[model samples]
Target: MYISKKEIEVRYAETDQMGIVYHANYLIWMELGRTALIQEMGFSYADMEKDGIISPVIDIAVSYKKSLHYGETAIVYTWVEAYNGFKTTYGYEIKTPDNETALTGTSSHICVKKENFKPIQFRKYYPEWHKAYEEAKK
Candidate 1:
């Protein structure tokens, strides 16, 4: 499978009172990873948006395995977990500098018209993009 990697530097402001990275930060990291994955796959979310479509997350789930601290670099690995004509699920793994898994998750999204929020047939709307995802998910 085609997996994309992105490195994020944890900031002090991103930590909780306990000095550990806040849980919600994982969602942001997933988005960064997803953006990288899309770029790696030769697609751009911006282009899709400019074409009057926007992909919105429908579901998300994350599991915390280890605590991430400030001043540390986190590497996020992203890949296509599932894809169909209607929706796509992106998988993610955030690891610490020491190579320990800090979090794992998946976010599901569906493409819709930006104007009316109506769902689109992704395969028909972007055949090449859909085929690329299909090949990557293999």
Candidate 2:
């Protein structure tokens, strides 16, 4: 897999009263990981919007393993888990400095028209994006 690594520092605000990172914060980290992976492929969501394209998450899932507390550093491993004509799956692994997994997740998204926010086939309008998805499959 072509993994994009991003370091995340656990902050007090990101944690709940129990000191463990808030569950919802993981979703934000997932987005950060996805953005990093896409940028690594030489593209940006901004550029996509400029081209009148939009990609919104259609489905998402997350699994928490170890608890992460404030002051610890976590690494997010992100990649294109799978893709097809209209859907793309981005997978992520969030771990601690010692490489212990804190979370695992996947987000499924589809490219769509910004004006209508309607789903569109990536192969037709975003061949480069589709090409990246295809190459990543290997």
* Model 2 lDDT, full chain set: 0.90
Q: Point out where model 1 deviates above 4 Å.
A: none
TM-scores for candidates 1 onward, in order = 0.97, 0.95
Query: Whole-model Cα lDDT per candidate?
Result: 0.95, 0.90
- How many residue pairs clash in each candidate at the backbone level? 0, 0
Q: Clashes in model 1: which pairs?
A: none
| Worst ten in a row by lDDT for model 1 | 129-138
**How many backbone collisions does model 1 have?**
0
lDDT of 1 by residue, 21-125 (tens): 999998999999999999999999999999999999999999999999999999999999999778999999999999999999999999999999999999999
